[model samples]
Target: MKRLARALFASVFLSVMLAALLSLAPVLSKHGSGSLPVFRVEQPMHLTEGTLVDFLSRQSMNMRLHHVEWERNSLTLDLSTTRLTNERYREMYLLIQRTLTQTDNVESVRLTVYDASPATPAPLMTVRATRGDLRKSPAVQQESERSYQQYLERFFEVKRY
Candidate 1:
């Protein structure tokens, strides 16, 4: 009876230890720098939410919308796509610039899209948009506010001025 109990205890202990070691294998084998490199967007342009999301979806890309500030007329999106070719990535940036330029509400668009794929190896894209200065003219302000209000009504349920 003693011998059997000892053997069972030994087997259980060994199994537990083996499981623990296997679980920690990833942590132990990780030798490279754990930090990811940051890439800056070269030239950013203004863009609309609809246009941005449409382009991404058309390309079958994934993205996360981080922050949207209508007052500042800016938005920040994180590119979550993994299959972007270098050329395609550049093309996307150009598309954004062109689209923003075409939009009536965008006063000036500047972008600095970049990727940090070589380290931590994840692709990221960021966009920032600024609305044109309509404060100078009451008519322009009213028109812009109306358009912005329409956008809000279409996309959000919250009441906004």
Candidate 2:
């Protein structure tokens, strides 16, 4: 009889612990930098969320667009990526810039990238470009790849968190 009572007590204790942990999940998730919750808001422009998602996914199988914060004339895109390379970021930026419409409400684009593989997550890097700067930067068709890359290197700032 005593053995059975002890077994029941142990199970009950474990159940209570599990319930407490489950309740704290949301609190923990909110504090974590690695995993982010996507907010659902009305998209600002015709540029479309699906287009950006598709473009980024096509660029790398490991990267994903976590969220987008749309402003009147600028867009802040949060991307979770395991692939970390300057060339890769530039290539993706070029692809993204090419897709933006000149007449749209979005004049500037900022990519706030987080390290997907980090255990204690912080922002990995940020890449931003304005439409006017894009026009003044090296032309894709007319200029050599080196010139375009140099332009990207000069204008696109990278800061590690």
Candidate 3:
């Protein structure tokens, strides 16, 4: 009876340990082997236009400008962040579009994601959608996601230190 109980306990312990490790695999794998810090987005939808400028200011210390303006009838949200990864950039971009487009009199939205890193040469990604485009938002998002995957496939490398 004692041996059976010990075996059961060991199996349960091993299973729990394996589960814990599996859960951490995604988080560990995403952050480049734990060498670099990761910024976890906490409730990105709560970000307001007022907070948008200030939040980005603190988030992108080296960024020269974070601006939002009216262009024609559409609202343009332009922000440059050196610290945010391409994946995070897409997320925040989509989040901002959803948040702003749903509020008040926004007819169309344009989000420009800029890589403001001094090391990086000039390159920017833009996503534009009108109220009509909301129906196709999922398709737009999928294209962006596919682009990110292709980017990772081309550039992602595993390094051991």
Candidate 4:
């Protein structure tokens, strides 16, 4: 009788452990690799708009994509980046504009940035420019993001930084 009871308890324990492991398999498959999984059926793009959004959102935990509107060759991005200093806002804006303008599908880009840290949804800034404008700067379309932001304020600014 005692041996039968011990065997039954061992079987139940093994069954529960197996059940728990099976339950976690799907989640572990998605996240256990320390990076997000890719399950796309489309052709691979190292940096398309989706990846761009991911990169921007990951820059700071507070920054997020609020909305998006796509026209024929123009793209509009609405971002909620909690109260940012002038430098930070410029950094994000240029990063977004420069990379997006390089893509084939995007001829122009518009960004409407909102400050989400305030109690009343404070300041908002909107800038819209085309690939031609982005490329016609002092760098002649050949500057790193840091250097590019320096001299193209006219082409890229809607108001203050």
Which candidate wins on TM-score? 2
Which stretches of model 2 miss by more than 4 angstroms? Answer: 1-62, 141-150
Residue 48 local lDDT, model 4: 56
Better of 1 and 3 by lDDT: 3
Cα-based lDDT for every prediction = 0.43, 0.65, 0.54, 0.62
Better of 2 and 4 by TM-score: 2
User: TM-score of the candidate numbered 1?
Assistant: 0.28
Pick the winner on lDDT between candidates 2 and 3. 2
- Lowest lDDT block of 10, candidate 2: 53-62
lDDT for each residue of candidate 1 in 1-161, tens digit (9 for 90 to 100): 99999999999999999999999877765656574336743454334565655543443323322323332344334343444454444454443444444444555333333344355534343333334322222342344544433432232222211
Q: What is the Å distance of residue 155 in model 3 from its true position?
A: 24
Residues 1-161, candidate 2: write the lDDT tens digits: 99999999999999999999999998987788675557745343454554555544544433576787766656777777776665655555664475354226567878777878878657877777777767676555654555444556565554557
User: Best lDDT goes to which candidate?
Assistant: 2
lDDT of 4 by residue, 1-161 (tens): 99999999999999999999999998987776775457744442244556556544544433567787766766677777666555555565565555454355567777777788877654467767777776665453444454433443556656544
Write the residue-wise lDDT of candidate 3 on 1-161 in tens digits: 99999999999999999999999988978687665446754443234556445544444233344567764456666656665565654454444445445344556666565677767534365555566545443544456546543432232221111
After TM-score superposition, what is the CA distance of residue 33 in candidate 2 from its true location, in Å?
A: 51
